[model samples]
Target: MPSSSASPPPPPWLQPPFLLPGFKPELEPKIEPMNCPSGQLEPFVTRDTLLFTPPNPNTVPDEVENAFPEHLRLAHHLGASSNDHRSVISAPVVEVPAGPSDIVGSRKRKARSAEMVRASIVDTPDRLYFRGLVRRTRMTYDSLRYLLLTDDHGRGEAGLSDEITRRRKARSDLTAGALMGNRDLWLNRDSRIIGCIPGIRVGDVFFYRMELVVIGLHGLIQAGIDFVTAGRSTSGEPIATSIVVSGGYEDDDDKGAVLIYTGQGGRERNVAQQRSDQKLHGGNLALERSMNYGIEIRVIRGIKCNKSPSGMVYFYDGLYKITDCWMDLGKSGFKVYKYKLLRIKDQDEMGSEMFKLANELKQNPSGGRSVGHICLDISTGKENVPVSLFNDVDNDKDPLCFEYIAHSIFPQQTSQGAGSMGNGCDCTMNCSMGCYCALKNGGCFPYDENGTLLRGKPLIYECGTGCKCPLTCPNRVSQKGISYELEVFRSIETGWGVRSFDVIRAGTFVCEFSGITVTKQEAEQLSDDGCLVYPGKFPARWIEWGDISDASPDYVPAGFPSTPDLSFSIDVSRARNVGCYLSHCRSPNVFAQFVLFDHMPYPRVMIFAMENIPPLRELSIDYGVGDGYA
Candidate 1:
């Protein structure tokens, strides 16, 4: 806590958040602060005036204050000052409160009722073992959904009239989610509890509603609430398990740690205007009972994300106790029930809160990130999005002077002229499976309508310069250059690493791994130098990420594309882009994809996000864990 020096308060965004006693600051992510040219960091300070700080209640909307009033004000006053930012090590799984009660003087409590042990599932070995499986399942469903949307996006385009539309009326999200659910590919269906789901993290993100169903986060596909019926609850009363605050029913409030959630029904979504009085029969009653019982409920907030292929990102923001619930008159003449849910203490930072800050930074990098910006665009206008260079750790002005190159420089012999290409896709809009390039690439277009790579293959064929398809075609994602903002910052453990100013969604194309291409023999000789990137050594994480064959024994799935043999490696020792600076991790948030367009026979390594990545988290790839930095 800062000394009361009677100094003025910082701006709303810079206000410090209240720190829970045992939060263990060491759990925050370690970001190497760029030395402020003065050769040192701003001396730990009042915790309020840092460059990119944590969430401030003062910065949130009016609804949060209106709903959670007194407590929110207390949270703002208790705003914690931060020191270390260590995100690698997560704190313990949040502990749910002991026996809450639908009836305060129930005989069950007098007779010694059992404490909530179902949440202990989060700490069990079974949960640990299935954690990786859960991740794989979620990503697989998303990738399949994206692939389906590719075929379904162009409904009335010119081409074969006989071409069959796969999912015209039904959305791709529903189809992909349904396929995964029917196969029993998901876990935890037999039992649903009042606390955390096994293997799901607080900040983990989902792109589709069906994804929520498959992963057992939220059971219902469309309804806002997922709860246990009257007979199932310990008290013979319905109990709420989870609720999604989707800004649906404009009455709900989402201010990160504190949420003012609206009960389901009786209103126009987004408009907040009520159609009829909301009833307390099903989910609404469950929520009220849960509040009286003191049970914690999972809160997944859905925010619109332009970076997401599905145009929405569902963020799991830990558990929240329904502290209060009551009926209130809505803006429309009808009555509505609103629940006041407070986020449990000591969990991870809400990804949605961080997302808003990241968006602000992207909109005005100069204004939001007002300090420690070493070089604005390290690429010097070479790429579409600017790559920022920063070093706030020490006076060390590093990443030792290397020439910034946008595209890989291959030997003249490997290059092929555009007119020399043997083929290209002719379809103008969304390239159908019947297109020439689609067929040449084995069958389907490898990307979704939003330009997210559906799956990585031995070789992903894109419309080359000779192709009749426009540059904005869905298949032409990699060639667009870096779509989002990246920063080269110095870290304590890993000297120099790359991160993003934007919250990168899973499967979005990041950048191409570019450098001077070298022959196999040359790569072997320079390998000892410890800078050569052997594409052959890259793992099949992409294939594994898209693997859903284990959904059932009877589900004979289409085979994953084989890993292509590579005779060359990229020499990124000198000239490189943001991709070269990506650190190595066994479990990385990004993966390498093999793509060939202008380079036809030869493929360029394209980097893509593996999951919903929050801003300022160091970007990593599944390559050799060497020298810490890439």
Candidate 2:
């Protein structure tokens, strides 16, 4: 009872701990709104407060609506008042079903995804470097995604589709549509063909072309350019008919896109300075060479049964033509030459032909790298002979060694009969008229002070062994082996050829043609059996006594049918020297001149350049035959 006034409740600020101590009630009454005449009312209790309006369950999707069965089920068993139940019943329920538009939207999303995948496949980087981008900032993954995932990419796709249609029309316009229609050329049971280019999607064997055959395998293959340097035709004739290079270096195949190389030089570059300098020279030179030469290259790919010790192995893929090429920054930010090639229609033919040739040459793949005589490297003074392959089958089978018969040659022989040997020359200095060999003809040496021939002339007989002059006599030239730096290399078209690293002037003495001295009869027999043989010039007396025509074949024995009226011939089918490699050409840079030095009954064949031969030029001779046959 005390404190009836409650001690005048402590002032609001100084009340008890509950009121004055800096404490407030944990729960507070929320203000309720009510309708009054003034349109607003303060906290007031009302029946509506206990019966609030609930959200309509039907507004949500079925999936979301199904997730709340407990909330919806409460309406059926509610213990609420009648008014509240009626309030719940008053709410409206709407059911909306998904329509065709929804289905179409979902399909559209899927189609976009598919298009994105296709674009990725088309633009996939061959080799991954950083990832998601090419060497330059020309394109990027985000941009690709935006373009491919939206109508923007679809516009491009439409353009491409139109282009595809155009290409298809072009293909239809081809010869009977049979050229590009045939897939049997490169396709086999093991691989499934796809797209215009069969192997671009899948790894396929390609015949890569390069400047150096030995190094091309690595460079072009690594760069994914399928091509192999083409050589001359089998007869050692230049392949001038087609702009395309079908196989390994064809004779005189150093033209056009044919010479385009990514690198400045080739594998044979030994000088450190030159190699270093080549690092910066863009493939511009190669590109220029290719364009100027109008060269076309053929690349092959196909599967074949390999009969090596390794069992059945697939060969190259189909053929492709280098259509276009240009320079671009590589993945490493360096200049890289890129080529765009198109598959050829005759891919099947090329594939089959290459396979057959490969099978034939499988036995001795290195060609002459390890056979016959030592491969003399002109770049390096090295004698590399494959001694292991040598045999004592023939005593005279000295492939590397040959005797230089030194005999006197006279233009007019009054005493000696045909092919009669002349006495030695007693020239203390250059051969003068006093020397018997020099009396009938000028000095046999054709080379001037610059080692180039001064002029072309008939057979100039040099002082031979009969001459008392030293081996250093100016009259002696053919007796010496190859004077200039020479390299014997295997040509894809021809079997082998002699090439030089430096340019050789006209009239330069290349090499002496020597082989097993076979009689004209023996040569014919060998030729009948598909062997290589060259006609030897006539004897000095025969030249003097008889009128010989360049068109006439060598003289054959009476028993044998009359062949070309050649005096003698050399058969090098079995044993030969560098001269055996000199190929034939219509407009040959070199010509054969008859020279007599020793007492040998037959005249020596000396090869001299008829024109200024550039570096890497393959010396050739006109065999007096037409183009078809070498």
Candidate 3:
């Protein structure tokens, strides 16, 4: 999946060390300089190879933002503001939409880019479309800054231009705003729209405001308001199209159904630092016109969400007609314009409100979401957050008796055994690709700050307790206990299954398969009786996520395995956690991954959300061949 050619023969779980002729197991071909990023082609790993790659070690964290500049505006997943900017040999297909008009790119490229952008927002299913959009946006942005801080190379800060360093000089909401703006990926840009966007549903959450920009939702990245000038409006008056209510203006009030929204402008960008009289211009004027014309403007509300990489999330709360508008004196003593936006009835429940309800459910366990909840916290005090046991289907008091444990229990013979593998990093805070730990993961960190797996790998090496990096380090994702609100609930079909009240974003860490580690022989004996969890049997979707072969055809896609090399399996019958209750399906939304923090011969079984999952949906995983109960 990584640039395996430049590196040593990757661990067995990865692609074959030698090139394949027609991907044959035999008949190794001679070397050739191909157009691949790795200078060799790649193919998906064979499913069986999962059984051979022992102690897979690519779970390291990405860029160390704590040790570098804080203002990286692009996607912040793997290395939030990744410095590992190794340039791709082939230039990225440059079909950005808002580049200099004077330089018209190829028409074919433009058409392809526009079509993909439109399809991403208007045609496909919400889960698939958003996942591809968000993933591609991050990958594109990461590539743009290629040749920045490399994994094995020296820090390349001195090589970056001022514009790249300053991150386009905007607020945090505008992460990757420039590329999406200048790139030719957008369509519906004529403005003057007054209704809901195609494909976008009410309560849909976005991690960045720039995502709102790319999908033709709200165009203004930094500005709170988006409007059509008087010349463009049908009524010959400035009119508003959409507005993002993110508490930029203190006068704004978000009441779920009724929003007492504040009109942008009047004060300096600095918080309460300067004051100015409101003007009847730009978005301010547009809001007034929209209110008078009874125009329903799209409203996306954003709030600080630590679960997101950008530390924020924007929820599309559907359309709201501007019912009232007026000039009002502001808290800073300057006259400001305000508008009352009334949510149109019969739309989906507001996403922000749902988020609020989910938070409440987490805090109100004893009494709620507690009516069916059997145990407020089945984990007792083991997990960082409690895992509730709820059974409304049948009167099951709790899951089969088992001791609650956080970390997987490894056999004495299988443990890394004492001396460190030197798998940790020296980073004081955020672990970067340059850290020794990252090198173990094929010269790249495996995750972003939010603990989202940037790319699926055979193994992910996290910053363990041996590392100087603090516990807050992003690399220590799997080590951290479950962070979401989960419940082990009984179902009519699946019996005991797991679900989440929180909207789990794609690639976010879910939980680990905590159990007593057993040898292969012991696992075989328990397989027929159930409760034997085999890490190698889970689907290896790394190729779908993005392998080096996607960039060029030089390398072959070999070793795309459904299984990974392993010496042990988990015996979850007598002792297990939430992961044991998860079900298996053909269209599963979750996947199992191999992770290690101590650089041991064995990796932990960490579960990650493979797609964006809405609240209360039963979580499922693919059992290699087809759908089956876990």
Candidate 4:
């Protein structure tokens, strides 16, 4: 080291923090000059007005006879007075020795205190990165002034004005001068002086500006530069993560379903309480709009253990479709909005699965081609027969003739007339205005719109031959015949049944149970043979001849003179269609609807998928079998 006569100048990093521009020199209290034998010296002083005594304990001076002037109090405090220099040379002193236990105990306490202080410091990666900037970076005082105290509010590059406010609120004795006087802002609380600036008098206005700069720099060091940065999803979409979901939903599924519970309201809540609150109150409107417009949200698990980071900060479960939203009583008795979300498969995952499924289907045992009229061997080893078989029903014998049904029932209602019913349009055979059959039936055509059905709806009528529409009309869902690739196979429990070759989405039209037209009386006679199928007749009265349709003019009952109700059954025992092999199931995959369009005396039975059916799954329908049949 160089000669000790010259004290080393303060570190370059420390000088910039003290000399920032927002500090005002006039605000600092003046250090009054006092006369000294050596020379007059101006020095820093404490605001407290306590009298300073000389080094010698034995020499007592009368207070009234030898008191120093008021201006000399600061000099005495700094121990820089000329009299203090002489007193140090002439004073006789005695040394006191500490016991071994006392010295050891004091050393132990200091070590323990240092450990405690170090443990309390925030030592995250971001914090260390910021602290490095304050300690390593060198800049001129003037240049650093613009960076730290450009504004009076201490709103600087690091955005740390809030920390200054917090510190001021916590300590009453902390003053701006004391903060500026501190030189080591990088040290943890374990240091001799904990804060960056230290050792100045309280209520000094100049150091107040200096305090702001110190606080701004300290906050930057502790929280890091990215503390205020927003989070984003892995897909690079900006995500809103403020809303939370607790309980599961009614229809949530294991693979991809998500149900969100927007938290309770009345008091300030993290999420929206009511559905309307998503629009009117708080920042929830952004989340609500995002979900409503099909934007993916960042779902954070409410439970802390499950909140472990998956990507940036939270696990990105996946993008979801907001299928439904409703209100219900929350845990707090306030109404809350519950949103139902369906998880969308990632494009990469979906593509891989599709390719695999397609390859499996191509290598099917039946060679992936239709054998005559039947789509055979959907399940390679599952079916007893190598291929499906059926007795071909003659095309002309179908009771609901596409050529005559419309003409027979609505003799006056031509395609040219107002040809609309239900939600259907009045399109003729050409269907230039779009098929009336597809429009009227809520767009449930299997060939279009992915064949999704609106559950529990009324019967849908297809275009008839009387209409000018071509055979290619979209309305001819069932009329176009079974479009789904199906295999007929014998079931272990329920005789012969039908299964699809590929996955079928819910609401897809499966097939119609088509056969010969017959009266209810005729169907009842053949019921014992297990040949006749009743589409919609109530199970309780199916056996009673009195309840059976007597539409035949010659078959009038003894008491009934008026025409009976128009319910007819089909005789499919001989002329078997593919649907005749469909087995009955308590929890059926397919549901039958009695559809009546043109005035054929009996209603045509139509079948639709009730739920999603995977490839090679057996198709079943509810046979309307009540307790008696069970």
The prediction achieving the highest lDDT against the true structure is 1
- Expressed as tens digits, the lDDT of each residue in 1-630 for candidate 1 is 112233234223222232111111111110111111133221222233221233442222111111111111111111111221111112222111222222122111011011123545534455544555566776767655554455443312222112113332335565555444333344455455458766677877676666777677776555567665543333334556788777756576777788887776664423346688877655777787667666788988888766554567788888899888888887676887888999999998886876777677677666565566688788999999888888777776655488899889887776575654566667777576678776655566667677776655666767788788788887788888987789888888877889897777788888988888888877666745766878888876766644444432332233433445577888888898889988887557899888777763457899988876777678888785453231
TM-score (C-alpha, index-matched) for candidate 2: 0.32
Global Cα RMSD, each model: 16.7, 36.8, 18.6, 34.9
> Model 4: per-residue lDDT, tens digit, 312-353?
111113234556656556555555545555555542222213
Q: What is the full ranking by TM-score, best candidate first?
A: 1, 3, 2, 4
lDDT of 3 by residue, 1-630 (tens): 112123234222223233211111111111111111223232111222121122213210011100111222232222112111221111233222222232233221211111111122443365444444444544333322232212323222222333334443333223333333333433244322357655456776676545665556775444566664433332334456777777656677777898997665555423542267766555666676567556678888777776655566778888888888788887777787778889999998888887777777777855445356578788897888888888777777657478877788987764462244564566886776578876666655666545556556676667776788788887788888888889888899888889887888777789988888887877766644776767777777544442322222232332322233576788877788988888877546788888776635677888887655656668987767654642
TM-score of each: 0.70, 0.32, 0.62, 0.32
Worst 10 residues of 2 by lDDT: 109-118
Query: CA shift at 530, candidate 4, in angstroms?
Result: 1.6
lDDT of model 4, residue 562: 18
Model 4 misplaced regions, further than 4 Å: 1-363, 367-452, 524-527, 538-566, 597-599, 626-630
Q: Deviation in angstroms for 345 in model 4?
A: 26
Best model number under TM-score: 1
Root mean square deviation (Cα) for candidate 3: 18.6
Give the C-alpha lDDT of model 2: 0.31
**Which has the higher TM-score value, candidate number 2 or candidate number 3?**
3
Cα-based lDDT for every prediction: 0.61, 0.31, 0.56, 0.33
lDDT of 2 by residue, 248-285 (tens): 21111222223332332221211112211122121222
